[model samples]
Target: MQTKKYTRLMLASTLVLAAHAGWASDEGTLTMGTSVNYSSGKYGTQTSTDITSIPLNVAYDKGPWTFKVSVPYIRITGPSDVVVGVGKTSATTSTVRTASGLGDVVTAATYNFYNNAEAQFGADVTGKIKFGTADSAKGLGTGENDYSVILDVYKKVNQLTFFGGIGYTALGSSAAIPLRNVFSLTAGSVFKMDEKNNAGFAYDYRQKSSATSAAQSELTAFYVHKFDKSWKTQTYLLKGFSDGSPDWGAGVSVGYAF
Candidate 1:
């Protein structure tokens, strides 16, 4: 599933990580990373809202199984009606407000069903849960949990890798904030520039969580560089074509594996 800022990075990173973490490795690998992301948009409003997020992520991969978690601290300067993760709701206001605090916590587990080294084909299934740790009073989140299941597949041809996935999410709802279950899709390709670098572009789409909000559609271009066997970095720029997404966004992250 897709949200904004930090969530966007997680989705893209998952694809790249899966591509790099081949199924041949029987030993476990631990990875940790952090990133700073920023996005701004009107969300069909007269006044623009800006959001900044810093997320800490950790993941472990062993054989066919992968486990991951992410937590974010967010700062929002916008209308009180705008909600983090879900974006603008039915409520509207011209008054702008600023709030800062913890955002949502996300966790997931993935299992690789098949991988063919010679054929360069692989498939996986992932189950994800999003905990509403952010403060609802501050508009950081909806104060409820969300669940998702995704099926992803990839094919490698020479130095290029193509990947895509489809997912369904069950969003929790409350009296103050009603939400609907939605479906999401993502497709992308990564081109290996050399032994140490790669670049790619991905597109994400999700149905609207609320009747009033627009569907989410975004395009992101990313670059990944390996500093060494245990260290790596990633940078990305995002452009949104739908009212449900941020107008523009960017982020940088560094990760270590051991």
Candidate 2:
């Protein structure tokens, strides 16, 4: 969701500059950011698990395209069956232990292919790859690459912007841990409070990626503030409605543009 929101902001900025010189920009933008996220849940288990991650992200926006990368440091305290982001796995052990190490690395590219300023509508296509950089022995991630693609669209009316997206993911699998491909959906709206501040809420749903896991449904509320053209920050809180999601989660991020 964080990455998707960034793409939306890029589109909005592109629209603002469109009248000056077409839809694509003459000068590219580079952005960097970091976020800290924490989540805790039982995930259909008898004991609760806690997960924390701090990720570094960077992006380059040129013309109507955006390229991004993210790498994270993760800490987990849970049973062996619980996987970060993926929830319960097929492991039969219930032993709880703490582990900390590098997490998976994700890369993505987004292309804005359609825009109508007068009608206040825009759309983008994005493809992502998640590399298995995390240590599978420690259960940080599946030691195989995963791929996904998404289509996002938005419309603006007055002080509000409505957005939605649909995506499909091809999960990586191994003989010991077979996985399932799944579809995901997201929808949300942002209310502009002023030139520098805005708040929004989003709902996300995803099909189960493993037979042992339940489908995921989560809702998040977020606020973003811009201090200047080159600096901004965001904070969010989320609640889960299914065992595949965290019972509750919160995160904060700060970004700089160059």
Candidate 3:
């Protein structure tokens, strides 16, 4: 009886935590989600759990182009970047504040470069833009314009799929950003979890380009569940390495199909 109860609890917990990210299904539909993030390292050590936001998104997959837009509302508590000198010793600290209102936005235009029955590759020109917010108590943002060129490739074998991408972002304007020329690589597998439902796990790694001495990296694990034939929900956990950004975060999202 104890073993059965433990199994039931674990299964229940997974069901409730499963979610989706990055992509939503819709020709022109919109969706939203919220997440809590933490940051640690040279600059500061902090945690922001009440950051509520939405992924205002629109997607279209047409003959040759797949267009996507993902913009979010964000609020985070972080340490202020400052150096304090006491006598002959100086210490640096990060200030904490509440950043609110409109947040970072991303738009992308992707074109298929190669596609066969089991394999495909594509390229995307993506833009990352930041909008000003009223909550300046916490460095709401550094108004900036950034662009990335992504090369994506994917393959399907039996019931498993492999996908990965490498992208480079050119950062400029506003505040000093750590990520420039970022490269991402991801791979995952899918299984028929239920007779009518599908489930899978994927792992992803990202490295960003930087002018600073230290750079940042991200490692993430994800699980996706499909409801019905056209909808999917997923959950993900991310860990950032190096510094210059958040330490850890988690999120969930829902998607619809047309």
Candidate 4:
């Protein structure tokens, strides 16, 4: 395959897995987070569109299990005919306040077959519900429920931490369950700025169940900042590869831990 061939292939694969990617810990605990996601691309002859959203997440964790629900109240937009604030498209976004109600719900449990606060090995099962509005025309939801199972591993070397997960989705017949099974590999490291601040970079590779499956990659940078004994904020920016959307986005939220 040519170079561009690989890029385009990767893009298609990423978009397929894009609708839901929980990037981190699944073990049940309690934490809250929020972020803004935006992306633009082409669907056909017409220039695709730009979407912006505010996603809110509430999660609970107990030992080696975790469950989370993300809600995104979003505005659909078409290509802009003008430019406004932040050099953003001038196109007027639709007034349709669609909801991803529990749309991106995820539940995971880890057994920690072996973990030393620096390294961990376990298996996880994830279930996603499609209760959100799926106006394929708007590219918001997949319109079906999806199931996945993965074996995960994590390691920490000083300030450098690495995490990798490999799994396969049932790929059952569902509007949301992708036509083909899926696979993922992820690695990330954290840098401590102090007792209250940490920053890091992450890289991810995802593919389908078949040999024809293209590998999609992502690059992300984020910060975890603590303001007080109980208040903190975690923020990150994720960019997809090739033709995949969500190519450019950022999010930040304040949270409290008890």
Candidate 1, residues 1-258, lDDT tens digits: the string is 134544554454455444653662688889898888888887777777788888898988788888888888989998787788787777656578999998899888888888888788888888989899999888888999999998988888888888888899999899888999999888888888998998888888899998667788888888889999899888888899888888988888888999
Tens-place lDDT digits, model 3, residues 10-73: 2212222121112223444332322232223332333332334455555555544555555555
Candidate 2 local Cα displacement, residue 212, angstroms: 0.4
Single out the weakest 10-residue window by summed lDDT for candidate 1: 1-10
Clashes of 1: 0
Give me the runs in candidate 1 sitting further than 4 Å from their true place.
5-21
Return model 1's CA RMSD, one decimal.
1.8
| Candidate 2: C-alpha RMSD after superposition | 3.9
TM-scores of the candidates in the order shown = 0.95, 0.91, 0.65, 0.65
lDDT ranking, high to low: 1, 2, 4, 3
The list of candidate 2 runs beyond 4 A from truth reads 1-24, 91-93
Task: Assess candidate 2 and give its TM-score to the true structure.
Answer: 0.91
Off-target runs (Cα >4 Å) in candidate 4 are: 1-29, 43-48, 78-103, 107-111, 117-138, 171-178, 208-215
Q: Report the Cα lDDT for residue 247, model 2.
A: 87
lDDT to native, each model? 0.81, 0.75, 0.40, 0.43
Cα misplacement distance, residue 63 of candidate 1 (Å)? 0.5
Compared to the true structure, candidate 1 yields what TM-score?
0.95
